[model samples]
Target chain A: MLKKGGFVLSAGLVVLLMVALIYQIKNKYYLDILFMTFFWASLAAAWNISGGYAGQFSLGHAAYVGIGAYSTALLYINFHVSPWIGMVVGGLFSALLALFIGVITVKVRGPFYTLITIAVAELLYISAIQLKELTHGSEGVSLPFKPGWVNMTFRERETYVVLALLFVALIYFITKTMERRRIGYYLIAIRENEDAARALGVPVKEMKLLATVLSAFLTAVGGAIYAMYIMFIEPDSVLSFAFSIQPALMSIIGGLGTSLGPLIGSFVLSPLDMFLRESFSHINGLNLLIYGFLLVLFVLFWPEGLWPNAVRVYRKWRSGGVETKS
Target chain B: MLLQLTVSGILLGGIYALIAVGLTLIFGVMRIVNFTHGDLVMLGMYLTYLLYKGFGLDPYISLFIVPLALFLIGVLIQKLVVQRVVGRPHEVQIFATVGLSMMLSNAVLAYFKGDYRSVQTTYSTDTIQIGPVFLGVPQIVAFGISAVITLVLFLFLKFTYTGKAIRATTQNRISATLMGIDVRRVYTMTFAIGSALAGIAAVLLMPLYPTYPSIGEAYLLIAFVVVVLGGLGSIPGALVGALIIGVVETVSAYYLGSGWKQAAYFVIFILVLIMRPQGLFGQRGAEQL
Candidate 1:
């Protein structure tokens, strides 16, 4: 599926679909869902950097997102800076924070490390709430929307979708590039067996830190974009546990470590999320209940996620093959 | 002033200890950190709350029924979901329980519509006379019940055959299986007992605190921290960790703001993770095991 020709073909198909979606979307509801799907796919692709490909699970991506959202919002609110620039500044800030945390926590692996990531993010969340002078406290910061390219805010909805699509495509391109290189091989080796990778003289800590920094930077960019689109940034909204989990969920669902796993995951889950919001608004938790059930079923039945399986089936049909097990 | 803080902290610690003991036990035996533990506590709250609301059963009287009901639910969850994920990778195990956490909490949200519900008894505001620190009757009762349950659990693990088998399994699953222990049965019982304790915590807390679908998160986070600080599988360690957290929370709330109390403990948690990931009493490689 990731062969150069195949990737090009698929990318063409997706671009065509995006083109159709932009003008054809009459329902604002479906447009919003599509926009979110692209946005979360981008965010999840960022998470896939450390989590999916590198096999370093961080439950603290929310920390970076929160930092990004808050940094851009605060800067724009106080200095009248354009968010187009604030996003870069926010990305840099997130990189520094990630470096400090990665330095301390890169050694720990597995669930213990997952716990540490959670703690760090929760600490950031609390700090955001308590440090009102800088963060504007729990009330958060709302951007005064002035629709223009300079502000990164747009008057048209489709423009935002186009921007989000570009972000996802950029992240996907980087992921594919990394996957075909020595760096990707090193990360895969480290994930498969850290001791073996170390014996082979891989700079395990450095690679892990690099992956974490890149992941945090991209996620922060996504955060900055989201804040501008919504014109509001709050700790609970951006720094939520659910925020951290969503990307991980999407990546895992579509197929962790695969180039297009997060995009597929987002495509599947985002519509459901939108449907539940629109139709089951009164049902409160039914959407999440189904989501949780699906997650359980996926982990149990197809831990490799739906992407690989879909590829295998498509290949089988294309080859006109007999019924045979992989 | 110090004495008052200490007394209150200890009382709060007792409540936290109840939540942590069950969590530690599950981790000890199954090697799976039950992320849905807080949800179980929340479910127990709704169960008792429903009884009080629908049937007019008093919160104090429904405690008995609530634990038993929760025990059955625990057994069902163990047999159905958790058993499948045992001996799996951390990713699978973590996500499974986290999935369960999302489901259970959201299920409650769907049913209850995210409203906070409280059950107040006839003596809801009644307080017992303590020399320096003012103690409410419900808190005193919760603390007393927690103490009793902890003692009983300690004795059970020490003297009972089933408990001994559980300890053996926790120490070494293969050896326990070799020694003719029904390791799976022991796992189910441990899960049930742990869940039942969460139910007790729910019932005990109902009189003092309001029940919301998300209320369990704060308690759950405290449980995770306490479990780690106390040593992953040590009951006595959980007790000690809870006391430390409780004191830290009360002290920080006094010095800092109440809003930052949980944050204060989270800092301590990170420090502990960096300085002593094995916790105060955990063995080396305990986390890996």
Candidate 2:
């Protein structure tokens, strides 16, 4: 659906980003930021499929992230499975969980559905803590730095950045394809009005479940990748409400339901997050304070999100300029 | 032992009822889930802490002031932020409230640095003997006060002109507006009343529980469970739901363990939401959800 000019602009920006990535390969800090950008972009894209496109607006997505991270770390630690395989296992596990929740909440809507999602995530979080013997509990699990391709651990930070970028690209491509497909239409229809969608032969429950499962699977994969990159897995970091909020915030700021919006949001917000965290490390909660303000500001003034707003502004400027000349 | 657990549970449930009443009132009237409801309670706790620390004010005395203070804050919040999102989409309302919740909790965290604080009243550790169950004096007093406030709220909603207007608006916003009830004013008043109720809960909890920036986070979920279990907008539902949750919590904690108590109730919450979303006292067709 992108216009020619927009497509060219985005393609050119991608090329420039690649060049920057290559040039900053040696800079660990820059590489870290780059990895985060791509990582959040992927997570937000995963959320967008269900939350944005299908209107699930789940506030408990961190459960999938935690599941993925735990699965990969646990499998690799105990059974010596490759992270590649473990990641898939995690994705399946998260998908199952999502399917169960989605089925139960299929008829539920609005705040009630959102509340159930929160309760489900909290249930998992509590379980992770209680199942201390298996999941390591709140003390968290740390992976040995056995740098190897099979382990998905690399000596160079560049590899992780590339992996993250590739992951985000895969998510974007899948989202774009879905947006052009019949399932996307069905999801949007269901989102608009479940009854109307069902009347028009759209399997609303099945579509919502499909969206939930797909979103969960993709998010879990991102979580596994994050665990491998960070070499640590913890309930507090991965399973926290912040993790759930971050993806939604990114998607909302970037433009909900749009493929490119999440990418733009992550690229902007991730760097800002790092900057805020660094600058205000001593001042606890300052970063989150700012995030809260931004969330409020955006919802109040620019509910359409950054990408759509930018597009509108650009179009307005272009038309205004033409009119002045005329 | 079971009786003791049940008594404590009932007392705790009284406090939970106050919080849930506030939440349910806002939800029932505005059709908006005030996610920041817990944070308002947290703010109340801090206000109590400050009053106790600075002015040597008893928590009971601050109870009167704190709720009034929070009611004003609620008025400001409803007017400045919530007003714009009124009648908007559910997602918009959700984000606005969630965002405000984040801000309030974090601002408190930033200012307070996550230290847990509590009021050291004379009766903080005092307990009363009643039929083989020794209950904390604070718990009994808090329960008594909360029950009274909830009753007052019920009667007010039933009799007072503004309260009836609030009820009318909750039942049918369009009709209330058509009748010149100033639906927006009812919304502001309802939100403020909810905030005041949260303030009351916070004051009552201060003697028993420590105050922290994230203290509200735990109560936030419990409040949701209570509000949902009791039925979304029913005050009586909140009271009954809170008591059920409280009993379940204590009984499970005794049998299963402390960690699993929360899990037990959460499981119940999920089942109830799935099986009976309208809850026990809520009208079947009251909520579209």
Candidate 3:
């Protein structure tokens, strides 16, 4: 769905991001931000498959993340398994859970679906907290400092940044492949009008389930990466409602239903979030308070999001400053 | 013990019914999910607390003022924020209120600094003993007031012209408009009424639970469950759902443990949604609401 100029611009931006990463290889703060940007991009892109394209708009994605993080951590801590393998196992587990949820929820529409998603996530969160023998409860699980490729743990921040970038690329590739295939259009049709899509002979339920499964799998993998980078997994940190909202927030702000939008959103907002959290640490809730206003303002005025708006501006600028509505 | 648990559960359900009814009424009329609902209840609690502290007004007496103030605030919120996104995309609509919820709860967090506060009244700890079952005085009083308010609301909706207008708008907005009903006015009025109901719930609950900025977060999910279980937009359904949930909660707490009480209701919520999507008292096509 990207245009020629947009493609070139994105390519240029990617190269620039790589160069910056290399230049700031030694700077821990910069590396942290870059790692998080890629991490969020991966999540937003994965979420967009179901939330944006399939129109699932799930607010429970963090459950998958928590699943992946906890699964990876528990397996490594208890069984001495590699996180790379554990993440796949976690992803499969998350996909199974998604299939169950999707089968039940695919028929429900609008806010009801949203409400269920929230409830399911909260259920999992509570379970995580209560299953103290397995999860350590709210005290959280800490991974050992075993810096190895197979472990998916690294001593250097730059290594984690590269891994996070690979995650972004992988999810981005899957998103693009979905967009190019018939399933993408079918999902969009299902999103726009499920009844009509069903009338048109599209497998509405199956497609939704597919989207949910895939979205859950990728989100779980992203969560595993997050666990590796942070080396800590806590219900409050990993399974909080904020975690569920953040990926959707990035996707919405960057622009929904677009491959590039989520990346742009993560790249822009993740740094801003870190910066605000750092500067306003003493103010408690200041960042979230601002985020609340931002969500309202954006939804009301800029509902189409920044990516589409930026493209419009770029096209306008390229057209020799013409004021044409097109 | 079981009887005591059941009595306490029923009393707790009274407060829950008010909150759920307010939420369902708003959804029925406006087709908008008011995510800020829990926060509004929280706001009511804070308002009552402040009134009690500043003016030494009993929470019982502040009840007269809090609901009215909440009604005005609800009207303002509807006109300013909820009005613009009445028929917007689901994401837009959901996020709009979710955003509002965040702002409100966090604003309270920032202002009050996360302190847990509750009103101390003469009846806060007082209880009535009847044949080996003990009932907190505040709980019984709250339940009584809640029942009275629900009855008044029911009468008003059944008999008053404005209430009829609200119901008509809910049943069929296009036809209601065609019939010379001001749908917008009905929406604003319904929203205000919903908030006022939540305010009533807040006042009743102050003696029962501690007040905190995030206190609403605890109740919001339960309200949603009650609304869904009673069938969205069905006031009577909300009442029944709240009672069922309250009983389920208290019984599960007694049996499984307190931490598992929320789990029991949440599981019931998921089962109901998956199995009967329309709820026990809901019409088959209540999904349209």
Instruction: Find the candidate with the highest DockQ and give its number.
Output: 2
TM-score of each: 0.96, 0.96, 0.96
Docking class for model 2 is: medium
Candidate 2 backbone collisions, by pair: none
Write the residue-wise lDDT of candidate 2 on B97-178 in tens digits. 8899899999999998988898888889998798899999999998999889988998999999999999999889899999
The local distance difference test score of each candidate is 0.87, 0.89, 0.89
Error of 2 at B51 (Å): 0.8
The DockQ of each candidate is 0.70, 0.77, 0.74
Q: Score residue A81 of candidate 2 by CA lDDT.
A: 95
Query: Which has the better lDDT: candidate 1, or candidate 3?
Result: 3
TM-score, model 3, chain B versus true chain B:
0.98
Local error of candidate 3 at residue B18 (angstroms) = 0.3
lDDT of 3 by residue, A134-221 (tens): 9999899999997878888777788888888878887887887788799999998987887899999999889999998999999999
lDDT of 3 at B233: 86
Write down the worst ten-residue block by lDDT for model 2 chain B: B280-289
Off by over 4 Å in 1: A1-21, A24-26, A318-326
Between candidates 1 and 3, the DockQ winner = 3
Task: List, in the given order, the native-contact fraction of each candidate.
Answer: 0.70, 0.73, 0.63
Model 2 lDDT tens row, A54-133: 98989999999999999999999999999999999999999999999998886678777788888889899999998999
